[model samples]
Target: MEQRHKDLLRENRVFLIDNLIMKNFIDHVAELLTANMEDTIMSNATNHEQVGCFLNILERRGKGAYQKFIEALTDAECDHVRSHLEQLEDEDCVDGYDDIDGPIRQETGNDDVDLHVSDWMKTDLSEEQRQTPISERAMAFVAREAVGVMEVGKLMGFTEGRLRQFQASSPIPSSQISTMFSAWRSQKGKQATVENFVRLMRDAEVDEQHLKNVITREYPPGDAMA
Candidate 1:
């Protein structure tokens, strides 16, 4: 009788440990799916492929365990999971479901540069928008508007010839322009106004005079010009 009692206790302990492990595994999978869902949805892409890959990994790791894990959840919990997945799928459709292009930008009349930058930063940009090189005209306009070309050139460590070349070139590689912008921003004490103008010029269409006026108003003759 004592031997039988010992055996039953051992069995109970094993069952408890197994239950604990299964609960942990299920929680981990849920967390992963939730994170993937958020990332995919926010970036305006479907998570089907990622979710499928995750499930495949779970199945490969332990098919029986995966099945048991699914069975362990209550019907309501399962429904909740399915609902979230379906909602994300629907959102992807509404978001245009293009990973390469991202969500389409809706044109709005509000051209307030600060507000524009704030809104623009909230969404993912298209590949072309991110990859396309900055035109020299655009760079020149930004420099001429925000800070003088001489100051930009000095901050960017450009030689006189290089500065002249940059002014003359039509499209400078985007990477170089990014470096210049970073340098300019750092030198300007990380001013949001300067950062906003650079981001606006790089990401959106703007009139030269309008941008110039915005910058001129923010930094009068002696402030940034000096």
Candidate 2:
């Protein structure tokens, strides 16, 4: 989760610093955070600094926290960054953005920038290996690696109708994955082991061998069944 946080901070710092990180967006994030961001950061920081500070705090919270922060940004009409995440694709070079090209930005005037917003998802375990029974990290990994609603649902034994409900209720795959994991754990009870969940992921073709390693070997002060 730390790396994802860093990448998001980097992305926002690079592209969003001037564009999305403004007073209106920061204020909206603060409102959404309620008490999460504390009074001091909200009251005493610049828009950019506040965002960094909030994310720094969230880095210790969990992926869900960062997700909510992104949602708050969306609520504030920062949809430009949202779309980049929505369809993890290489968008057409944003014609004429010249600043710091390669991975973050381009020069300007006559320059172009390629936006592969999917880069933040390169790492599987972004947070310190937590011992949550439901394995928040695993769910988040699947949410990032898995594709398509019905495909994942069917592979995990969710009926099309029920999967539709997840799609309806959760705006993003991360939330949908969490909701589905809740449903899965609720239904499966103590049977929802890390191995079982990993099976579902493999069946759905998420291809997370590294995550498998983490779950089976390195990560297990807690797995879903622990």
Candidate 3:
């Protein structure tokens, strides 16, 4: 199989099985590796053959193949597999696997980690809440509005691209984008307007094409249905 397919299989295996199942699979792989460990790594040709054989074994075993393989292995062999998996998990954690969410986040509206809401909120008040100028408030509010749009986009199955596109075209100024988004959201069941969106982006000096790309990621293109 292609490397991409192999990668996909690994991901599927990891996500579909819980810790116990994973342990069983690891045990099986360990047993296979141990049987040929002496020569498996010493010779590249043997390593390829062994890998193919291992994959064959796994395929024939089906969903519980790993567990079954483990059941047949000696206790010592099983320990080796367990140790390997522990090491893999530790490596994955230390490598910052959690940061992968930077591409597509689950918390669209809330910037807890990815969006950083605390920083955005700072713009909410000026020297004395004198209601900083509508222009600046409007710009600050864009972040809030973007949050809501992002949340809605996520609910609708939109991507990052689509969300940015919608934000770009809103008639609301960047300063008041948040309020505009809030107003649109309060409308209940009605989708946000796009005509006004175009007007706003034009005012903000945002590139129309660039916004389209952003929205493409956040929502679906051509159709904002997400």
Best by TM-score: 2
Give lDDT tens digits, candidate 1, residues 4-64: 2222223334332333333223444442222333344334232344433333333222113
What are the runs in model 3 whose C-alpha is more than 4 Å off? Answer: 1-48, 56-60, 69-78, 90-226
* C-alpha RMSD for every candidate: 21.8, 11.7, 19.7
**TM-score of each predicted structure versus truth:** 0.21, 0.37, 0.20
lDDT of 2 by residue, 103-139 (tens): 3332233232111111212233223332224465656
Ranking by lDDT: 2, 1, 3
Model 3 Cα shift for residue 179 (angstroms): 69
lDDT of 3 by residue, 127-199 (tens): 2221122222233323321323444344434567756776677644332345444444444223333323323
- Model 2 spans with C-alpha error above 4 angstroms: 1-134, 213-226
* lDDT winner, 2 or 3: 2
Clashes of each: 0, 12, 29
Q: Compute the lDDT of residue 16 as modeled in candidate 3.
A: 29
Cα deviation of 24 in candidate 1 (Å)? Answer: 76
